[model samples]
Target: MNRAAHLLLFAALALPLAACSKVTADNYSRLKPGMAYEDVRGILGKPDKCSDLLAARSCTWGDDKSYISVTFVGDQAVLFQSENIR
Candidate 1:
């Protein structure tokens, strides 16, 4: 093959591998709504900061990579939202 043909073939082969490390929605897909706070913590690891409101049965977890604020009532998550910061 000519030089130009070889370069094109190589670029086409490398494109798929180049995008393999991207983070997608699937990474956090297993975290279903209504899961316990502990389970969510286990899946996402420790948060950068967390606070508890005694009157409200909920916790706000602020992570460097994502914000996961979950409401819990008797060990059950009633509300949850996860978003990427980076």
Candidate 2:
């Protein structure tokens, strides 16, 4: 009975781990630095803020907590940075 209880407890603990999300559309961790703004926009949807990234040629997306800064040199995001406040 005790062994069965321990097995049940281990399975319960592992359940959440097994339930962890697989890579999908909403998973932003898969995003890369050089992806175009339009491509990224399609994946992330509208952003919280839009402004200059580095200079007038670049653009960025950010919020109060986190930010994804993208610099455009021609037709793509040539430079990118992500920052977290806290």
Q: Which candidate achieves the best TM-score against the true structure?
A: 1
**Residue pairs in clash, model 1:** none
What value does the lDDT take at residue 63 in candidate 1? 45
Candidate 2 lDDT trough over 10 residues, lowest sum: 19-28
Residue pairs with colliding backbones in model 2 are none
TM-score of 2: 0.46
Estimate, for each residue in 1-86, the C-alpha lDDT of model 1 and write its tens digit. 99999999999999998655323345356567678777867765554455566634655444446555567766777776667823
lDDT of each model, Cα atoms only?
0.62, 0.59
How far off is model 2, as Cα RMSD? Answer: 9.6
Q: Candidate 2 at 29: error in angstroms?
A: 4.0
The parts of candidate 2 lying over 4 Å away from their true place are: 1-28, 52-56
lDDT for model 2 comes to: 0.59
lDDT against true structure, model 1: 0.62
